[model samples]
Target: MSKRVNRVAEQMKKELGDIIFQKVKDPRIGFVTVTDVEVTGDLQNATIFISVLGDDSDKEASLKGLNTAKGFIRAEIGKRIRLRVTPEIEFAFDESIAYGSRIESLLTQVNNESKE
Candidate 1:
C-alpha cells in the first residue's frame, strides 16, 4: 500500500470507530472496538476489522448490525473525509487479541510447571 492508501485507511479507521460508538444507537451493537482497516488499492472497498467483547451470539449480532449500518457508515465517512468516492465498508471479526491472550496463558502455565 502506498502512503496515500495508508493515510486514508487510518483516517477511516478512526472516523468509523467514532461514528459507530457515538452515532449508531442499535441495541445489537454492543461493545465494539475497531481494530484496523484495510483499503483496496483503488480505494473502492474497505474491510473494517473489529473486536466484540462478548460471546459468540454477541459477536454475530454486532456483525449483523454493522453490516446493516454500512450504508450509514459510508455516508458518514464521505462527509468526514474528502474522498472522491467513499469506499464500501465490510465488517470482519478480529481474533488476534484473543489469540494473544491464549498464548500468554500457555506461556505462564509452562513457566509455572518449570518452577514446580
Candidate 2:
C-alpha cells in the first residue's frame, strides 16, 4: 500500500511539473518548479509542493491561479494517468530550499565572524 502511494506521488510529481510548465499559461504563474508531492494514503488528496522563483506576491498569485485551475488540472491528470479516482490537488509552497539557503548564509556569516 505504501509503495503504491509512493509511486503515485512520484508520478504526480512528474505529471504536475509537465502540466504546470506546458498547460498552465496564466501570467500569475511565473517561473515555478514542482519540487515534491505528497499523496494521502487513501489516494483521495494530493498536496504538491512547489518552488516559485519570484517575490512573495508572485508566489501568492501563482498559488491562487493554481487553485482556480484545480478542476482543469485534475481532469487533465485523469485523462493522462488512467486513475480510477484522481486525487484532489493542493498547491503548497516549498520552503525547504529557501530555508537551506538562509542557513548556509548564516553559517558563512558565522565563519567570517570567527575569522575576524
Worst 10 residues of 2 by lDDT: 75-84
Query: How would you encode candidate 1's per-residue C-alpha lDDT over 1-97 as one tens digit per residue?
Result: 9999999999999999899999988899999999999999999999999999999999999999998888888999999999999998889999999
Question: Across residues 1-116, which tens digit of lDDT does each residue of candidate 2 receive?
Answer: 59999999998888988998999888888888999999999999999999998889999998998888889889888888877899998899999999999999999999999999
Clashing pairs in 1: none
lDDT of each: 0.95, 0.91
Predict model 1's lDDT versus the native.
0.95
Model 2: lDDT of residue 10? 94
TM-score of every candidate relative to the true structure: 0.97, 0.96
Q: How many residue pairs clash in each candidate?
A: 0, 0
